[model samples]
Target: MNYNESLEKLLSLTDSERVSGRGQHTRRYDLTRMRVLLDELGNPHLNTPTVHITGTKGKGSTAALIASVLSSQGYKPGLFTSPHLHTFRERINFDGEPITADEFAALIEDIWPVLTSINHDGSHGFITTFELLTAMAFLHFERKKAGFQIVEVGLGGSLDSTNVVQPQVCVFTSISLDHTAILGDTEEKIARDKSGIIKDGCVVVTSPQQPQVMNVIAQACQDHGTAFVQSSEECTCTLSSADLYGQNFDIVAPWGEFSFRTPLLGAHQLENATTALVTLQVLNELGFTVTSDSFARGFRSVQWPGRLEVLSEDPLLIIDGAHNPHSIGKLKEALHDYFQFRRVVYVLGFSSDKNISAMIQELPYDNAEVVVTRSRHPRSASVETLASEFSRLGVSVKQLDTVNEAVQYAMDLAQPDDLIAVTGSLFVVAEAREFLLNIPPELYPSLDAGMPIR
Candidate 1:
């Protein structure tokens, strides 16, 4: 099959990423099924030096940073992340560029027969769409002869499809209460689920987390006989200055002290940078050639889109995918620290399953004008639902049916000194970005280009 044909067949399968409601819990997320599928595919995930990362937030950014460092160290690194904002090919990249359309289609075609056979057999149960994508990524990385592959966990780490590989180094970003209905309601419960990525005898790196959450991760490392390293204890970051464009900071790590200026915003990113730096340090100890100069070059050049991304300067538009309360709180703090504005305009959208009430409370909407809208995503919450939630919070809200409409309305109302923030969901931020940046579908070669995944 061709690229478009293969994409159609892939979309025809059941995609849990686009599904909503508690029924998601009923679907099996078994790693055994994933293992069987990979085994049938010749176990492509094995014998690869991998860096596995998982957490509630900042894991994607951390993975991107690690891949950047590996690339700087003269290694061909493959990066696999999830829930692409603009294109499906964004989920898979080698040496900072997305896999070409032909490459993606070739991988899909290569795995089609095995996927069909597994579905036809009853004992193996049907594999998830994500599982197929994971298998395809492993095969693509191995075929391309990547020096290292950086994999990010899709959901809870234990039963996640990407858990099949034994990583050379494991990194965990901050853990928080997200996916509560599926994972658990408390931080400790969620931490236990994330700690599942810790493998026996591997070195695990983490950012500073809550004491309870830290205890859970530490206990998991002990159980697996893995060495745990905390970024906060091993390194310290002091922010010298920050603005909407980026931030400058000094990191004192075990190797030595280094200063970095990054286009990625927020003080929270300091933790992510530290986590990536420490992971690179661990890789160096494992006989890798990453040096402080590599860290310096990579840390400054990494690009993680849609997380505190500043798109425009005239009206000061910032788009972030802060879907949950914990992330929204960080977004609010970043906004306060980065920009000086006369007024703030919040263009908000969220999925139906998100804690809309709690997320709204965390947003800095006390003195800001709120515009509620829905993205093109199937699971996006309705404008009426969001408007009602805003009203309940004693905030006046303007309801718009689509993300583009909301962003245009905010722009029309804002002054040059006012800030316009498109947030609450990555889907919403994706739409706003396309509209504001005037990106055309032709910009990406994939047939499914400019389409939001999940």
Candidate 2:
């Protein structure tokens, strides 16, 4: 099939990311089916050493950092992430470049026959859109003969489609009450589900977590006889300076001490950088030839868009995908620490499944003007719903129909030195980025254009 046809076929499958509560109460994932599909295709995931990362936050950033470091060490690493900000190809990358459209279409064509054959009898159950994408990534990595692969878990770790690989290293970033309805409500329960990626005799690295969450991970490592390394306990970071452009910090790890200046802003990013450093140290022990210079170069060049991204300078437009309360709290901290503005204007949109009340409470509405809006996604929460939540919290709110309208309204209300932030969900930030950057529609098609905005 061609590019558009392949995209259409993939979009016809069950995509949980767009449809809320699609399989919340059901066991939608089957690891056995995943393994069977891979086995039929020669199990390409086994062709390269892999690093598996999971958590509620920082998984994407950490995975990118690891891939960048490996690339600096002269390795072509295949990176697979989830829930792309724009095109679907952003979910798969090789050596920091997205897989080209021709390569993606070719891979889909090669796998379509196997996919149809497997679902012909319906005994194995239909593979999900995410599972198919995961298989495609593995196949592409094997075909290119990549030096390494970095995979990010799309959801809860244990039953995720990407969990079939026997990774050499497993990393867990901060865990919180995200995807609670599916994974579990409490942090401990979510940590249990996330710790499922720990394999016997493999090295596992993690960020600092709550006491209960840490207990769950430590016990899982013990049960599996895995080596557990806590980044917080083994490394320390001190921020020297920070601005809207970037931040400078010094990290003291077990290997040695190193200073870094990363374009990724915020204090939480320092923690992510430190976690990546510790993971690289483990990889070095596992026979990788990564050096301190490689780590320095990688941190200096890593790029993770839609997370505290600065788009313009006149009115200072910043966009972040801080959908959860914990991430929203970090965004608030960064705003206070990084920018010098007379006023702050917020353009916010969120999904229906998020903790809207808690997220609204965490927002800086006391000192900022809030504009509630809906993105083009089908699962976006209505502007009325967000306005009601803000009003209930005694915060004044303005309503807008679309993300573009909200951004324009914020810009009209802001002074030259004021700061305008478009946030709450990645879908919202994506729309705002397209509007502000003047990106072509053909280059990044609207995945939910015809759907209702509210």
Flag regions of model 1 displaced more than 4 Å.
20-26, 441-452
TM-score of each model, in listed order: 0.96, 0.96
Report the lDDT tens digits of candidate 1 across residue range 1-454: 7777667656656567865331222356677778888998889898579999999999999999999988888898999999887777788898899988899899989898888887778475676667778988899899989999999999989888899999989888999989998789999999998888889868999989999999999999999999899999999999998877788999997679999888889988988998998999998888988988888888889999899999988888999999999999999998888889888999999999888999999976656999999987768899999988988878899999988899999999999889999999988988887888886422222213333454
**Clash count of each predicted structure:** 0, 0
In the order shown, the candidates' Cα RMSDs to the true structure are 2.7, 2.3
Off by over 4 Å in 2: 20-27, 441-454
Q: Which candidate number would show the highest lDDT if scored against the true structure? A: 2
Residue 137 in candidate 1 has what lDDT? 89
lDDT of 2 by residue, 1-454 (tens): 7777777666555667767444312235678878888999999998899999999999999999999999888899999998887788888899899999888889888888888887675576777778889999999999988999999999999999999999999999999999998899999999999998988868999998999999999999999999999999889999999777788899987779899988898888999999999999999999988999999889989989989989988889999999999999999998988888978999999998899899978866656888999987878899999988987888888999999999999999999988999989988998898788885333313354454221
Clashing residue pairs found in predicted model 2 = none
- Local distance difference test values of all predictions, in order: 0.86, 0.87
Candidate 1 similarity to native, TM-score:
0.96
- Output the lDDT of residue 232, model 2: 90
